[model samples]
Target: MPFRIFRRVLQLVLCANALRVYLISHSIRRVIIATLGTALLLQVAYFASVLLLVWRAWCNRRAVEGTSQRRRGSDYS
Candidate 1:
């Protein structure tokens, strides 16, 4: 999946230069760029949310681990 994204971003970077030239020469280019930018923004937002959820779950796991560690140490007494 990430490799697919890497290919997409590579394609975007390679195409953007031509897109800039197209933008200056045609009205249709503006609309295409606008649509692509909006779609890219939405994708980025979704990726951020998934990352945030993973981070939150990781923190909760760490907290549980710490509590279990303390309980184990207390048992030695």
Candidate 2:
């Protein structure tokens, strides 16, 4: 009977250890996922800013060209 009780205790200790390890690993996985999500968001924001700058530059160039053409036409007339 004593041997049986000792064996049960040993099993409980092993189970508890496994549960602790699993919890630690789960928490670590969550941290890694959060870090990756933040990095992806930052990258998206960087690209969006770059695209906005390029679009503004293109519009400004078109406006300047249009004004210069109008001036040339008026001068000829």
Candidate 3:
């Protein structure tokens, strides 16, 4: 019974090692790297869009302020 238990333990260890090796194979590594890179790219794009929106709002605010100043100056003249 002890020998049978030892055999089972050894089989489990071998199976675990095989799984580990398969996970660390080149194709799997490439898939993991690609997934991470795509995620990073998406994050950057989201930030870029947020930055663009803020920039547009700032420009619009500046334009409105400039127009108001022009109107006030024209009224004084």
Could you say which candidate leads in TM-score?
2
The whole-model lDDT of each prediction reads: 0.74, 0.69, 0.69
Alpha-carbon runs more than 4 Å astray in model 1: 1-27
Candidate 1, 3-62: lDDT as tens digits = 588568756754774477566767676657665775677578768878998999999999
* TM-score, structure 2 vs. true: 0.64
- True-structure RMSD for candidate 1: 6.3
For candidate 2, the per-residue lDDT at 57 reads 100
Ranking of models by TM-score:
2, 3, 1
Best by lDDT: 1
Model 2 poorest ten-residue lDDT run: 13-22
Put down candidate 2 lDDT per residue, 1-77, tens digits, no spaces: 25477457655654565456557776756555655565566557657877998999999999999999999999999
Q: Candidate 1 at residue 58, lDDT?
A: 100
For candidate 1, the lDDT comes to 0.74
* Residue 30 of model 1, lDDT score: 68
Q: Give the per-residue Cα lDDT of candidate 3 at 54.
A: 95
Better-scoring candidate (lDDT), 1 or 3? 1
